[model samples]
Target: MATRAEPIRQLRLRTPTDLEAEAVRNVAGALNALLADTFALYLKTKNFHWHVSGPHFRDYHLMLDEQATQIFAMTDELAERVRKIGAPTLRSIGQIAGMQRVLDNNADYVDPDDMLAELRDDNKDFVQRMREARDLCDDSRDAATASLLETFIDQSERRVWFLYETSRRGDGTGH
Candidate 1:
């Protein structure tokens, strides 16, 4: 005998709102995309942390570990924000893989400087994405999301600065 498939229950959010449901949906979609990218970056950072080697091995490894932790920490916040707005969040790695825009580095070996440069660029790209999401929130009058994105943007900028400075050559001129 064939078994019947269970019906999927749709989320029934009851929060009263002055904004249109469409606007909330749009913002949640944007947040989900950002969440996927953040998870991808976190995994990439962890990969580097685990495999990084060279003269600055210890420093780079420790830094990447810290950065990965920070990126991982954002995933929950992003998901919760989407839920708070009456939307379902990513439910699986496959869903995140489908939504992510960040590039992955899977080579067996990478130069220390190359890793720093790549991460720096990735962080910069993440900042740009965050700003774009913040713009979406602003357009939708989503002050809460906009405010949270401001903090994320600041953190990403700091990460970019650290990576850039670390990757720079010590020519003594500080150029």
Candidate 2:
């Protein structure tokens, strides 16, 4: 006898909030993209951490591990923020890949300095993205998300600063 398959039920986890539907939609959209980028950056940081070599191996490894941990910490809060606003967060790695703006670095080997420079640039871009999201939150009057983005932006800026300093040579410029 053939068994009938059950139809999937669409779950609507609509949380009640004073924010308007449009505002929720806008904030959720921005947050979701940011979350995806966060995941991408986290993975890249971990990759570099695991693969790093040369004289500064221990320092670079520890720094990337710390940065990776920090990046991973943001994922939960970002998704929760989207859900709190009555929207569905990203459900899969595929969703994250689709939405992520940060480029992946899948190479056999990379110079440690090059890795730091690349991550610095990516983090700088991420800071701008957060700023844009904060502006959107301000426009939507979603002070909660705006405040969260502010914290994340500051953290990202710190990451950029670290990467920039580490990658620098004699002149202090990363040249």
For this target, which candidate reaches the highest lDDT against the unseen true structure? 2
Name the runs in model 2 displaced over 4 angstroms.
Answer: 1-11, 171-175
- Model 1 TM: 0.91
Q: What is the Å distance of residue 149 in model 1 from its true position?
A: 0.5
Over 4 Å off, model 1: 1-8, 13-16, 172-175
- Model 2 — which ten-residue stretch has the worst lDDT? 2-11
Per-residue error (Å), model 2, residue 154: 0.5
User: How far in Å is the alpha carbon of 124 misplaced in model 2?
Assistant: 0.3
Each prediction's TM-score versus the true structure? 0.91, 0.91
Alpha-carbon shift of residue 160 in model 1 (angstroms)? 0.2
Q: What tens-digit string does per-residue lDDT give for candidate 2 at 1-175? A: 5334322222347788899999999999999999999999999999999999999999999999999999999999999999998888999999999999999999999999999999999999999999999999999999999999999999999999999988878654735
RMSD of each: 3.1, 4.1
29-144 in candidate 1: lDDT tens per residue? 99999999999999999999999998789999999999999999999999999888878889999998999999989999988889999999999999999999999998999999
- Reference-based TM-score, model 2: 0.91
lDDT of each: 0.90, 0.94
